[model samples]
Target: MSEAASIAEMPPRYDPNGVEERWYLKWEQDGRFKPDLESEAEPFVITIPPPNVTGELHLGHALTYGIEDILGRYTRMRGFNTLILPGTDHAGIATQNVVEKQLAKEGVSRYDLGREAFVERAWLWKEKYAENIRQQFRALGCAFDWSRERFTMDPQYVDAVLEFFIRLFEEGKIYRGWRVINWCPRCQSAISDIEVDDREREDSLYYLRYPLKDGSGDIVVATVRPETILGDVAVAVNPRDDRFRDLVGKTAILPLLGRELSIVADEMVDTEFGTGAVKITPAHDFADFEVAERHHLDMPIAIGPDARITEVGGPYEGQTVSEARVSVLRDLGAGGYL
Candidate 1:
C-alpha cells in the first residue's frame, strides 16, 4: 500500500461547499438568524462590540466570535429568543487615516479638498468597507440579526445619541472643564490616556538662571522646554529640600522675559531632577499645573495648538517651539542666563 493511497480511503480535505453552504444559506433564508418575536420563550439579547469599519477579522475577533456563536447556538437550542445585534464602528481615527492615505496616494491632503469634500470622501470609504465587515461576520457563522444592523452615524442612532446628550446636559451631568491631557501635535488633537504610547527616550535637561529680584544672586532652575519659560509662574523646589529652604520666600526675575517668578516650595517638585529647582509652567507640565492650583498661581497658555509660542512669549511670539528654542537659547546664552 502506498502512503498517498492508504487502505482507509477518506478524502484529505473536508469540503464545506455541499455541507455548511447549504445549511447556512437555509438558516439565513428561513430567518433563523433573527429571533421569533411572537415566541413565548425567554428573551436573550447581546449587542456585540462592533469592529472598526477600516479593519478586518484577526485572530482575536475570530476567537471571540467563535465563543459567542457557541453560546448563542446553545441558547437557541434551549428555546430562548436570541437577538444578537450586529454593527460596525465608525472608528473616527482609523477611518480618517484610511482616507488620508488614499489622499496621499493622489498627492493631495484633507485641507486641499476642504471640510465638506473631505467628509464626502470619508462617507464613501465607510460605505465600501462596512459591507465587507458584515460579510466577514457572516463567513464566521455569527447568528447575528442583520436586519437590526447599526452604524453609529445612522440617522436613527444619531438622534438617539443627541437625545441622550441633551438629557444629560439638562440634568447637569456634563460640563466643560480643563485639565492636563496628552496632545498630538501631528494629529492636532487631544487623545485619550489609552491611546498614549509611553516609551523611553533621551533628551537634554536645561539649566537656566533665574536672578533674584533683590539683585542678590541668581537661582538656576532646570527644564526641558526653554520656550515655555515665557509663561513661567514660579520656581518650584521640594519643600523639604534644605538647599532651597531660604530661597522659598523670595522672588526670582525671569531671565529674558524680566517677569517676576515667585519662588514657591512644593513637595511635588522632584529633588533629583535637574538642579533641585524646577521652573513651574502650569500650562505645559502636569505636575506644575497641580502645584499652581494648590499654591494659587496663575496658569497661562504658553504653547498654542499649532505648537507655536503664544502672546505670552513676547519676542518669541508666533515662532514654532523648535524655532523659538533656538532663539531663546541664543538670547539666554548672550544674556548669561543659560
Candidate 2:
C-alpha cells in the first residue's frame, strides 16, 4: 500500500477527550472569547436564547445548541469574528419554585424566612445551578462569549422591565383592574397570555332540573358542570325554539334557593343540547356574562374568590361547588321541585 494509504488504513485512534478540554481552556485563557473592536474583522453575531437557570439540558436545548454551534463554527471558518453569546434566565417563577420546594423539606416557607433571607437563599441556589449549566455548555464546546454572560433578572434587565412598565403606564396603556387573569395555581402568579398552553379536558356532563314558579313542572337542563348551578342567573334557549318559545318571558325558580330567575332566548344556545337550554351563570362562566349583559339580567354571584360557594348561596354557602351540587340536587328532588 502507498504510504498515505497505509497511514489512512491504520486503526483510527482519534480521541476528542483531551483535545476538546485543552482547546477550550486555551481559547478561554487567551481571551479569544472576548470582543476586539480594534480589529477590522467582519462581525457575525448570534445569541442563544437564554434557558431558565432552574432547568437542565433536555433534548430541546441539545437541538438548539447543535444548530447554533454549527452556524458559529461555519462563520468562524469563513474568517468572520463570530460572537455566540450564552446566558440563562433567572425565571422568577421557576427559580422560586425550586427554592420553595427546598424550604418545604425543612418545614419552612419563603414568607417565614422573610424576603431578604429568602432572596439570599435563592441567590445561593442560582449560583449552584448556573455553575452547573455553565459547565454543561462548556462541555458542548460551544464557541460562546462566556465572559459576557447575561441573566434575565440581572440588574440591567430589571431596569429595562421597570422602564417598560413605567413607559406603558405613562402612555395610559398599563392600568390595573379586577379582571380575570390567567392564574397559575402552582406558580401562584398571574401568567401572561402568551405563556399559557391550551389543553383538552374531559369533563362531566350533568343533568339538572330548574323548577317552575307555580311548583308544577321542572325544566331539565344539561351542563358540563353541575357545580356551577349555584351561580345560575338565568336559563336561556334559542329564540326560534318552538318548545321554549312560550317559556321565554317566564321566570325559573332556582333549584335550592327558590330564587326567581328569568327565562331568556339567545342565539348563543346550542340547539342540540338537552332541552336546548343553557343556564346563565355569569359569575362562574365568561360566556354567561355576555348573555346576562344582553338580557339586562341581575347577576347574583355564587362563587367566591376562594372558588367555594359564596354567602349568597345560603344553605350551600361555605361548601365547595362540587359538594354543594349534590346537596342542592338532593333537596330539589325531595321537595318534588325536580
Candidate 3:
C-alpha cells in the first residue's frame, strides 16, 4: 500500500478529546467565531441564555449549548454572518446565596463582612464560576464569540438597566407601594412570582370561629394559614349562598385580635371550599388584597419580611409564621373557638 494510504487504513479513530482544544484555540486566535460586521452576508444571530455565574454546567446546560452550537454551525455554512454571543448572569439572589453559604462555614454572616466586602467576595466567586463555565463550553466545541462575552453586572449593562428603570418611572409605568409579593426570608429579598415553586404538601387546616356582633351564632372559617388571621379586615362570603346571605352587612369579631371585621359578600369567595367562608387578610394574601380594594377595606400587615408575625399580630408578635400558627391554634382551642 502507498505510505499515505497505509497510514489512513491503519485505523480510523474519531478522537474529539485530542483535537477539540487545538481547533478551538485556532478558531479563537483567528477570530473565526466573531461575526464579520463589514461582510455583506445576511446577519444570523443567536444569543445563549446566560447561565448563572454561581455553578458549573449541568446536563441541561450541555443540551442547550449543543443545540445552539448546531444552529451556529449550520448558519455559518449557509454563507451567513453568524454570531453566537456568550455571557453569564450575575444571578443576584442565587450568587449571593452561594457566597453566603461559604461565609456560613466560617461562622460569619454577610452583615459581618458588610455590603462592600460581601460584594467583593461575590465578584471573586463569579470570576471562578464564570471561567469554569467558559472552559466547559470550549470543551463542548461551542463556537461562541468570546470577544463579545458579557456579564449582567458589567458597568454598561448596569447603566442600561438604570436607564430602563428611569424611563418606566417617567412614563408612569413604575410605582412602588406595599403589595403582596413572594418573599425569601433567608435571602431577605422580594422574589418574582416566576421564582416560586408550587407543590402539594400536607398542611394543617385550622377551623376557627368568629363571633357575630349581633346576638347571633358564630361563623366558622377554615384556613391553612391561621397566622394571618390577625390581619383579617373582613369576613367574605358568597352573596348567592343562602347560609351567609343574611349574615352579610353585619360585623364579626376577630377571635384573637378582637378586631371588628365587616362580614362582606364577594362573588370571589368559593362557597364549595372549606366552610364556604374566607377570611380577608389583604396584607398577606393576593386574593384578599383584591377583595379589600373592592370593599375599600383596610390592609393590616401582620407579617414582616422575616416571616415573623409583626406588631399587628398582638401577643404573637416576634414569633415566626410556623411558631405563631401553633400559638394561634392553641389559643383557639383554649377559647373553644376552634
Using TM-score as the measure, the top candidate is 3
Kindly report which residue stretches of model 3 are placed more than 4 angstroms away from their true locations once superposed: 8-12, 40-42, 106-108, 111-114, 192-199
What does candidate 3's lDDT look like per residue over 197-257, in tens digits? 8999998887889999886988999899987898999999999999999899999999988
Task: Tell how far residue 15 is off in model 3, in angstroms.
Answer: 1.7
Q: What's the true lDDT of residue 16 in model 2?
A: 74
lDDT of 2 at 38: 76
Best by lDDT: 3
lDDT to native, each model: 0.87, 0.81, 0.92
* Worst 10-residue lDDT window, candidate 3: 9-18
After TM-score superposition, what is the CA distance of residue 166 in candidate 3 from its true location, in Å?
2.1
State the weakest 10-residue window (summed lDDT) of model 2: 177-186
Ranking by TM-score: 3, 1, 2
lDDT of 1 by residue, 1-338 (tens): 78657846866788866687677778888999899978999998888888887767788998987888888888999889998888888887667878999999999999999999999999888888888787777777888888999998899989999999999999999887677778877778887675678898887888999999998898998877888898899999998999999998899999888898999999888899888999989988888889989999998888888889999999889999999999998999999999
Q: For candidate 1, what is the TM-score?
A: 0.83
